[model samples]
Target: AFILGFALKDILANFFSGLVLLIDTPFSFGDVVALSDGSRAVIKKIGLRVTTMYLIDSHSEIYIPNANFQGENIINLSRPTSHYYYTISIPIKGDVDPARAISLMEKVVLAHPDTMGELEGKLEAIDNYYGHSGSGVKQKLKREVGRMRLLAEQDVTRMLLKIEMSLKQLSEF
Candidate 1:
């Protein structure tokens, strides 16, 4: 009985610690997290001594040890507050006004309903002459991609709901 109690106590401790870590950590549910070995997963649940994550490309669940979580650098792609940045680059090869291009891209990003309130967008130009043969006109665009990613979330959920409904309808048919 005493051994069982000790095991239970340890489990409880780990469980609460996991909860605390989940709340305090940068990552949250549905956020893409990169592990140390370059493996990436979407957070499903933060469990005791284990975090349930789904591999982004494979759509498979991966139980990551909590101990490893502390040592590894976790890149959280989603957080309510601004934590990550996404960039879209457009290369122009001619007598193109880089500033104007940036402005246009910025406007397009801001105009999107998904990007309007949640994320802030910035545009900059990088003249890459040394690295490449041609003068690389790179427009640096930054925004919290996860803010707009919620739209994808909603769309996926809506799609699943639609599939379920269709299945039900077909069953009746």
Candidate 2:
């Protein structure tokens, strides 16, 4: 009995940890999360004892035991919003006007329809982006991105609701 109990200890811990995760639902399927090790991955599946993840940096699948997963500090990047802001550093020469360079870079960045800017300005900049030739293509790309974001959000919400209902049913048992 002692050997059997010792053998089952880790398994039982993992099982309970997974159950708590299901109840809490910190992240849903397809949500990108940063682990304690500073690695980022997308949640693929949550099983009773293990969670499957796709590592974004390496493009590999990893199955993490639920107990260890629960112990790690994780940040959900896909929750609430998926807009990831990044910084880029540019070196300017002594002869270049810093103010003018900065202004031009800002305009270039804001010209992309996917960036955060006034809707009218972004739409207007599409003409500048493609020399006024691919305006229709730019508009279509923007619409597609918007639709994908909406669908991802809806999927997360739906999954959360289903998890909540399933937990409620389990509690009654």
Candidate 3:
């Protein structure tokens, strides 16, 4: 009787906690959250016994006990803004100046007209680079791109490339 009571206590706690989480809205569907284990994932669903999440790094779904949040911090990356941001990395030659690279990137991004004007697309260097070892390349740009702009730019780029090829063929003929 005593063991059953203790087991039921944990289950009841989880059930109630799940209800509170659903109502409180600490996170929602598709909202990305960082778990205490350092796993960043998107909320897939919330159930009575567990909260389901799809881990970004592992590409797997995990069930976190409803009562699990009590022990760790949950960083909600999407709660602040509905617009999701993605990183676009640009690799420059080792000898190229960082400032000039940034300026050229700005021009290329601004020319697209889809970067959402005056957005000041952020540029920051990342540590990972795969150039020749002796070159000492210290600059790589990471820019935040909106979902819509990313898709649109991809389509536009493909179309422009096709057009360029057609123009070249016409000139040759």
User: Top lDDT: which candidate number?
Assistant: 2
Clashes, model 2: 0
lDDT of candidate 3 over 140-166, digit per residue (tens) = 222222334344444544655676677
Candidate 3 has what TM-score? Answer: 0.46
Summed backbone clashes in each candidate are: 0, 0, 0
lDDT score for candidate 2 against the true structure: 0.73
Flag regions of model 3 displaced more than 4 Å. 81-173
* Candidate 1: tens digits of C-alpha lDDT, residues 25-140: 55655677777768778888766567889997788898866655555677664443445457766788679888887665656555433332322231111111111233334412
> Model 2: per-residue lDDT, tens digit, 4-108?
999999999999988777667887566789999999999988777999999999999999999997568999876544365788877789999889987767666
- Candidate 2: regions farther than 4 A off: 81-173
Residue 33 shift from truth in candidate 1, angstroms: 1.3
Q: Estimate each model's TM-score.
A: 0.43, 0.52, 0.46
Error of model 1, residue 50, in angstroms: 4.5
Instruction: Please say which candidate is ahead in TM-score: 1 or 2.
Output: 2
Strongest candidate by TM-score: 2
Instruction: Report lDDT (CA) for all predictions.
Output: 0.57, 0.73, 0.64
* Candidate 1 similarity to native, TM-score: 0.43
